[model samples]
Target chain A: MEFSSKVLEKAVNEISQLPGIGKRTALRLVLHLLKQPKEQTVFLSQALLTMREEIKFCLNCHNLSDVTICEICSNKNRDHKIICVVEDVRDVMAIENTGQYRGVYHVLGGKISPIDGVGPNQLNINSLVKKVKSGAVSEVIFALSSTMEGDTTNFYIYKQIQESSIITSTIARGIAVGDELEYADEVTLGRSILQRIPFENAFKNY
Target chain B: MEFSSKVLEKAVNEISQLPGIGKRTALRLVLHLLKQPKEQTVFLSQALLTMREEIKFCLNCHNLSDVTICEICSNKNRDHKIICVVEDVRDVMAIENTGQYRGVYHVLGGKISPIDGVGPNQLNINSLVKKVKSGAVSEVIFALSSTMEGDTTNFYIYKQIQESSIITSTIARGIAVGDELEYADEVTLGRSILQRIPFENAFKNY
Candidate 1:
């Protein structure tokens, strides 16, 4: 880990500060940057600085955006009244990729994890509760992953807006489209069986 | 893979250009950066730019340095007459960590790989040959890895300096210190047996 140059050492230290990257990986990356054209480093550095300084969060959904409100939240044709709650912008992108959901998203930023010192207050939970209580929303879909933290956050939000008249639901947990039934975990298999849709309804999308 | 923010996308693209990083990992890293304080991103960007712009290579050995003459080359205590030829600065650092060798190093920059468009001309081989021809160095140790390209680079350099009145050697190839005999590869185990030194010599360091 001993660097011959102070500048190289400083760069490696900064790069290794990132999650999942170690000193060896940082050294390899820095050496690669050294071998590439100087413009590559310039562009990388400039892009990172500009993004960090100028990036904005959507006022409505809390997703990353270049404007005050994100495109999804601002689209008039989309069903903003039917909000799909997610953990972060990545989930927003994932759900958008599916092209199955036309509703707006309310990015929670992260889950309620006590061990990580992250609670409901630190996320966008309060705003979501307020929005639901305002009676403008007709349905709120909890689309976070099925981990303990995701379930905890979902329950917390459900309790907050339970008195509201809007429908509250979670995305169905089932075996993935291409996955074999036998390969599905026990909990997912059991839940899929318990929540089985009508035989004719399965062919409706097809 | 679609990004809601152009700035975030640009930064992810730049970061993903590094070896071993993919778009998903890049997004994770960028999102992590966004969660951190602005100074963290600023410092990382500044450090990368400064390192790329200001880093220097040693005049004699081509190893990375802040000055024309690296500390190893400038030190009078090390034996300048014995040069350890290595693939890059990483090898130099590895050997330096061992603290067993007293000789200075001549970094080859990289091995000769025709598939990668890397030839001896692209490396520091010419300077090493010229240094050897000067008759100041009495022994040249080949410390490059034992890959095909490494062997080719070694033999090529050996042929260049063969006529000079200097001894040439390569680092030993054998089983690692703590490796179990049963799990050792045949070639490595055979070589270890063939190149075994006197039994008493193994305890010399102790």
Candidate 2:
């Protein structure tokens, strides 16, 4: 778009660089910002800068934290022996929201995607191995996506820790709890059937 | 959602305040930024701040600009006598993209919507009237949206300028270029048929 203000154009360009946001969306956002008080922009900019500068990854779990070690990893009430492996901080957040798991997380940062040039070395696999090799972690649960990359990363991590006696498992794959079985994809439906637990164990929450 | 980092929470809060962005989406955006090199955040922050600090509105048109007068209004190639009244700068950009118009623009800033607490006085109507009263403009075309608010604003402006001898017109409302007449809405189809232009005028661009 032909923006009369160079600054507006620059701001739109910067905003559009984000994933899923296009030039039209960026323009809408910038125009919305312009409509509001100038202080909103100041606050937004400050918040982003502050987050960028101060945010740190947990030294132990590799999850995003404000300090050297995250609260989940540092809390004694949580089970440190069970390490739930996730692809990113967002996954950690998602699992945390369930309020089901008591285990601390090991954030791999991303899956093993060869096409994207992301290898095992690029992720926090070594740190996780170090944690497991310390003999403190009893079980390592793989909670990555169901995609091929996710399975590859899970297998890669499982192989690295297979020598140890620590029990390794992956999160269950199935149709979502609220979804209709008829609409479920064939692969997931088949897997869900094969991995079906006893009726009592499945409805423990109820 | 529970956040390990305070800065991340704050950034998410600010981002989620924008229209259509929810907390989950905001978290996704924040995490994406975290995954990328820190320089991207710096660039985004710098662009927002620079734009907010340096941006100015054109004094004459009330459109966002770097200077007192916008480039469009100052361009000698555009017809200064014919002004296309629009709701905002995006509309101006949309019309400009067609590469058909040669007239300058008068940005109303926003449509008059009592429901949203926007009144005629709150907009740039006074400046538009001042421009019209100067007696240079020969035609004032209302190119606002077909919404009630847009129509009200156009009518209000039309009434304000009715005392003057200058001709006033509104852009046509009709079936879109590629629309099928069978599926067209009654209101628009009826209006298109009632205000049907000569066959030659309809295909002038062809």
Candidate 3:
């Protein structure tokens, strides 16, 4: 991993600091950049710098945005009352891509992971609790993942707004649409059986 | 793959332009950067910009370097008369790491690949041939990869230097060290048997 040029070494060191890239991979990527037109590197550097310097988080949902409020939050057609709680902007994007939900989102930024030193205060929990207490929202749906952190965060938020009359619910956990039941984990299969719905409700689209 | 922020989208797009990186991975890396302190992003951008703007290639060997003549080329201790021809700077680094070859290197930058629109004229072959004809180099070792393009490039260079008294040789190809004989490929195994050295030369270290 010895580099003849200090500049190339510095670039490789910086790039390898990324999550999955290693020193050899960084060298390959840096050499690739060197092979391409200078304008490509210019565009990449400028875009990264501009994004880091100018990007903002939505004040309402805490999702990444270019303005104070994100496009989803500002949209009038989408239902703003029914808020879907999730981990981060990635989860928000995933839900948005499905085109199923009409309610807006409340990005918590991350889950409650004590191992990682992330607590409830570090997340956007207080703002969500305040929003629910304000009585402006009709429903709050927990759409976090099925991990322990997700359940803990869900329970913590549910406790904060349980006394209120607002109906709080969680996204259903079941076998994936096309997955075989035999391959499903025992916990998921058991939950699917316990939470079975009416036949007509199961295939409403059909 | 939908992005809410234009700046974020631009950065992801530029990053995905790199080799082996897709839009999803680019988004993940970009988001990881955003989660870290802004100074990390600044350092990465600055390093990349400086490397791309100021990096140089050795005028004598065509290897990536910070000066006109590389350290290996200028060192009087190394055997300048025995030149190891390689595909690029990576091979030079690999050979340097071995600490076995005291000969200087001549990086061709790339092999002759007609499929990729690369030819002899596009490489640093002319300079190497001129150097050989100057009667300074006594030996030229072909250490390019054992591919069709590599063979073609080696043969092309050999034809130019065959008229001179320079000794020309290619790197030995065989089963790698610590490799099982049963798992060795047929071609390499056959070559190893056919080119078996004398008993005294088989294990010089032993």
Candidate 4:
């Protein structure tokens, strides 16, 4: 799409570079900014720049942090002995939102995706192994996605710390709690049946 | 949702202020930026700031431009005597994309919407009337949306220039080209029948 103004064209190009945003959507957003107060643009730009310039990674979990260690990893109430492994800070935030898990996190930065040229060496695997081998951890929970890359990363980390006597586990995968069984996909339904739990175990908190 | 870092939280808040973006989506975009090279964020911010600070509106047409008069209004090849009145620069761009019209444009900035506290005075209506009164224009095409507000604005402008000999007309409303008759809405289909054009004229641009 052609723009009447060079500045508008440049702004649209930059805004559309973001994921899930198209040129048309960027144009609409830029035009909206033009209609608002000039200070709004300054605030937005400054916020983005400040975040990118000063953001730091947690020393222990590899999650985003303002300091060396993130809040969850540094909190005394969180069970540091029980580390919940995740792909990135996004997963850590998602799990934290549930409020069910009280354990600290070990963010891997990413899963083992060879197609993307991401391997075990490219992740925070070594730091996690060192943490487990230190014998300060009792249990290691894998909260990675249920994809091939997640499984591979989980197994790779499990093998590295297996000799350290850490109780390794993964979050359970099945149909959603409130979903109807009739509408469940065949693979998930079959897996749920094969891995059925004890009747009493399903009502742990409820 | 809580963010681990203050900078991340601030960035997410600012980004989510844009239309159609939510806190979760903003967090996702911010995290994606974190994963990229820091220069990308700097570039994006700079482009937006420059556009907002240096952008100008064309004096004659009120369309976005880097100069006093926009490219369309200044172009000698375009028929300046035949002005197409539109809602905003977006409409001008949309019409230009069709490559069908050679006339210049007059951007109204917005239509008359009393409920939204927007009246004719809030638009670029007077400049349009003044341009017509100069006796340089022969025809004025009303290319605004087919909404009630659009029609009201068109009628108001037409009344203002009625004393002059300038021909005032609105875009044709009917079922769209290539649309199936069976699925056509009653209002549009009925209007198309009532405003039926000459059979040979329909084939002019086919």
Candidate 5:
């Protein structure tokens, strides 16, 4: 028996590919889309298409941007000397919304997960190291998550920057373990940034 | 300070307009779109656009379809003499998935909600009356939800169809209060369809 239409089947399959959407949820979304005004659906499609066609990785910070340099990197008022390293663009937006930090950001694209076959070479770590080695940078703040992999990347970057005579710091542990930086509220993120500690004795036990 | 790019701002606003999606969720969805491959985003966008441009209300049943007459309406094997009236297209799909009912369907667009200003005339009730008066229909089934408004609309349609000689019936009351027909599992829905009671004196008190 033909259970569903071809287009609907394809659409449902695609929706099911999303993080938490299951087959039933995918069906609900497709049915909802079918009922929506044609213009609304068109807008959704156009936004997604433009998101791919127009947006690109910022050459300087690796944040999503329409231009080579993201708005944060190009802004003159932002403190270029202080760079906050984060795992993704969502983390950068979370930090930006705090309004406490005037520093720019560098998105590592992803954390080093050996289980997932991700390594330092796969991330934008080389560009970050080059940026720090230029000697123009004053302080490098680690805004990566407090996960095990996050700590490993943080220590790796800390060791890389310490050899270049640049000051290195990591956001305070006030952020509870296993919590994502992207989901952290603005006030908590701001407090965490304000309570940053020097990384000279970082990983002293390890 | 500009929080996001102009296009991104517009896109985020558009995404936030969707039901259950807030500003932060909209931002997350946008970031997820950015992470997806260009082709994936483009395909989703095109699908949305195509859904709007290609799909239309089936003239016979008011269900969404790519053609004037829907697949069910055009099917030669479906029982034309037995018509099931429902609130929306999703209900039609649910009933169809059961593979038990071979009857055609008539979508009422919405239930009678005095609070929401939806009246009997606002729905496709007049056309339903016209279809019944044409004399080919033997039985008319009310598969609307058990909500207050659904009950009101079902009674209203019943009143309109009582003048005709055609038989009328309603799906069983085993479906719980405030439950949507679309979300009901196939087995329960199939049981309800099989145990449908005749419209005359089905409600004891009313």
Candidate 6:
């Protein structure tokens, strides 16, 4: 009987190890690579090797970096006084894409998921508390996902810094920016109701 | 503004260079790696590194292997008389997955695409012809894709080996095995009509 090339199989195995890729997708990718220019295939393989061997974590915030402190932490112009805590580095990219934030970031590595046996101890929470206690930071923003594990992690961090004087905040929960009120999901409507604040309380300059 | 970690960014860049991966998908994969256990992450990185550094092409058939020859080429029990010529290592795989053919394979490295400036000289056709000329081969199967380039390649090889005594054949093309007649696309239906064989003689034994 016929059998696939062991090298192609090995390449497929390595590609399939990525987050969303499966065996079939990996095979397709291998086929595509075969059809691509030889230089492109060689470059991609070399890039994977270099990334695995060269890149490392930032010692300060536990984010990925080539240096001890990440670029964000080392930049003097960035606002070190404000820090945004997130579940992963991808969250940092998401917020950055919005062009609204101007603060350094601390990646918790992941959220607390008891079912997966991940807890506060598994994350870099101590480093965050230490950063807050340093007195250099004035505000800490929790910018985690809205999932159950994310909420549990947010609450844990909140309790950890409850006695500290640094102002702590979570991302607002309400109708999403572009979403129509009439088309709002039940969960979003419910959360908006519970977190509702009084309107028209302050005097307006007429 | 908040930013992704440098190591994560580097990893995403590397992953996105693979066939079919985009920037957003690469980010998702990087985040997934961060969520995995340290050992798992380490294993995946090491696997990628090893795949690039350890895998080598078979000296004989150009298949991937850890040593001088691939498993298929090294196997003594398989048919050494019949060689199936294909465009790449992946075609060897597609044929292998069917578990039908007992012949060995010769990967041409690529097909003949004049617009892309690919010719027989750029392929492994020289090695294939040499292998056939050695007089150990009886039948040579051109199991290439049914495309313009593939047809041009087959014709080129046929002309080059016109004097050789080996019998040559191609994979049959007709209504695909599992395709419904009503839903069959026009191109496939036309090809089936053009290549129609005598069913009366084919069913004589039955």
The model with the greatest TM-score is 1
**Candidates' RMSD to native:** 1.1, 1.9, 1.9, 2.1, 7.8, 5.5
- Listed per prediction, chain B TM-scores read 0.98, 0.97, 0.97, 0.95, 0.81, 0.85
Model 4 chain B scores worst on lDDT over the 10 consecutive residues at B197-206
Off by over 4 Å in 6: A1-12, A24-60, A67-71, A74-81, A97-99, A126-138, A159-168, A172-206, B1-11, B27-60, B66-77, B130-137, B162-166, B193-206
**TM-score of predicted structure 2:** 0.95
Per-residue lDDT for B69 in model 2? 87
TM-score of chain A of each: 0.98, 0.95, 0.96, 0.94, 0.82, 0.86
TM-score of model 3 (CA atoms): 0.95
Lowest summed lDDT across 10 adjacent residues in model 5 chain B is found at B1-10
Instruction: List candidate 3 stretches off by more than 4 Å.
Output: B202-206
- In model 2, state the lDDT of residue A104: 90
The runs of at least 3 residues in candidate 1 whose Cα sits more than 4 Å from the true structure, single-residue gaps closed, are none
Off by over 4 Å in 5: A1-13, A23-36, A175-206, B175-206
lDDT of 1: 0.94
**What lDDT score is found at residue B32 in candidate 1?**
98
What would the per-residue lDDT of candidate 5 be over residues A133-152, giving only the tens digit for each residue? 99889999998987889989
Q: Distance from true position, residue B90, model 2, in Å?
A: 0.6
Q: Whose DockQ is higher: candidate 1's or candidate 2's?
A: 1
Tens digit per residue, CA lDDT, model 6, A46-150: 554455556667787787777777778888888888889987767776787876677888989888998988888989999899888878889999989889999
Q: What level of docking quality does candidate 1 show?
A: high
In model 3, what lDDT does residue A159 have? 94
Worst 10 residues of 3 chain B by lDDT: B197-206
> What residue pairs clash in candidate 1, if any at all?
none
Residue-pair clashes per candidate, as listed? 0, 0, 0, 0, 1, 2
Off by over 4 Å in 2: A203-206, B203-206
